[model samples]
Target: MRTVIHKLFFVWDFDKEEKWLCDMAAKGFTLVSVGFCRYEFEKCDPGEYGVRLQLLNHRLHHPESQHYLSFLEETGAEHVGSFLSWIYLRKRTSEGAFELFSDFESRIKHLNRIILMVISIVAANLYIGIFNILMCFFYHNEANYLGFINLAIGLIGSVGIWKLLRKRKKLKNDKQIFE
Candidate 1:
């Protein structure tokens, strides 16, 4: 029975995901936090104590007396600071396939995709523009050097300009940009 319990502990541990933590809490499975060999007992509350958060395998180094809450991450007890409880879980998201990206990364990826697409189109057009400019200047003997300058500027400014314009177009637009 003891061996099974220990194995179960390892299997149940998950990163500090809200949905999983919330579900575990709803299931009445209290997290037991124990200090390592050299460490000393800190506090009864997971909030007040500096215990480890949930690991990938659900089994943390829980020892004996500690506060376990239902909602927030399994790290500590209840507190206002728990708002960032989603941090650890989100941090792990990048390592796994079906995990949520952080707000900043999500935004950056979305913006990057849009920028890349626009740049690709503009780059093709820039090549076309350059071709036209060459034909006019060399073939027709109408030296328009300013045409190359404009093409350079367009390529450099493509990303920054599009991001600013599309960011606030609509609430749904931002979501759509990422997909």
Candidate 2:
């Protein structure tokens, strides 16, 4: 049997999303698919699988992505699903915990990739918003409403990017402390 749940989280809150997925798995709900903010879970024995989330910088159609997925599969991790640039993977708990990056340096590099992605997105949104606002002023028409909306979205993206940068900074500091 399958169950579906609806929930939304910002891209920057991926840790929270991963934790939620893991919690569902702990309760016998193995994630089968995810679209938009909805998650489809299949019934399974509690603690049957351990889940891991990864940010893939490459496009899904990229040849390197296939190689990366194949590498992970060779290591016993199953690629369950992918959305945008994020990939979901699972491994049987009996096999041990699922860890994609074992070393602190690799983990830091992964986080840096995520931070760069978020920054790029935020910059793009801001640029679009400014352009829209300029167009609205020049046209003096209904486009003003859309301009405002775009500005709001850009503001939200900026905030999200700020939060991600802070997280990245913290991770770097922690790495320094460890080394």
TM-score of each: 0.27, 0.92
> Residue-wise lDDT of candidate 1 within 40-110, one digit each (tens)?
12112222222123221121223221122333334223321111111122111223322333455554454
For model 2, give the 10-residue run with minimal summed lDDT: 141-150
> Candidate 2 has which clashing residue pairs, if any?
none
RMSD to the hidden true structure, all candidates = 18.4, 1.6
lDDT (Cα) of model 1: 0.38
Which portions of model 2 miss their true places by more than 4 Å? none
Residues 65-101, candidate 2, lDDT per residue (tens digit)? 9999999999888988888878998888888888888
Model 1 alpha-carbon drift over 4 Å, by segment: 1-102, 141-179
TM-score of 1: 0.27
Task: Quantify how close model 2 is to the true structure by its C-alpha RMSD in Å.
Answer: 1.6
